[model samples]
Target: MEINKKSQAGSLESSDLMVYVEPFNEIKIEVESSVSSQHTEEIRSLILNELEMRKINGVYVKIQDNGAMNLTIKARLKTALLRGAKNGN
Candidate 1:
């Protein structure tokens, strides 16, 4: 799916994360995490997998994590994508 504009989901509270999505020419992901050094790769992989499953492309994703779990990340990503696609933002 194509993201028409910028959109975001989730929160910055403890054990949560915020996800932002925007239209782009290529897929790019930037992640800022409380545990970046230890879990960056894992979190990136999870996000990529989610996008791949939905056949999403040509978008930029930004994630701010505060010790969230995989499920939370997945949900936030999904919510952000849906909102962006629907609202064209």
Candidate 2:
């Protein structure tokens, strides 16, 4: 669980969230957000789509949000992916 490098991106602007992507060809998603239930579901849906599209696993994502928008969520997810890639995910 070491974040050796952080992508050159801004931080999340909402609640604190942590995502762990396992290594595999399957779509496995786990999210922890401080947003409301509806918003959480929305975010989960978006994240699932992203993970499926990217096909990433064996990596973990941790997000500290501050009321981020859809774009922000995408940015944060990409940042985490970049970081995980750099760190040999």
How does each model score on lDDT?
A: 0.88, 0.54
Q: Score residue 19 of candidate 2 by CA lDDT.
A: 40
RMSD of each: 1.9, 5.5
Leading candidate by TM-score: 1
lDDT of 2: 0.54
Residue range 1-89, candidate 1, lDDT tens digits: 77887899999999999999998888899999997667878999998898898788788999999999999999899999988884433
Candidates in order, TM-scores: namely 0.92, 0.57
Candidate 1 regions with alpha-carbon error over 4 angstroms: 86-89
lDDT top scorer: 1
Weakest 10 consecutive residues of candidate 1 by summed lDDT: 80-89
- Residue by residue across 1-89, what tens digits does model 2's lDDT show? 32334333454444434343333344445555566667767777787677667765434344444456777778667666666554544
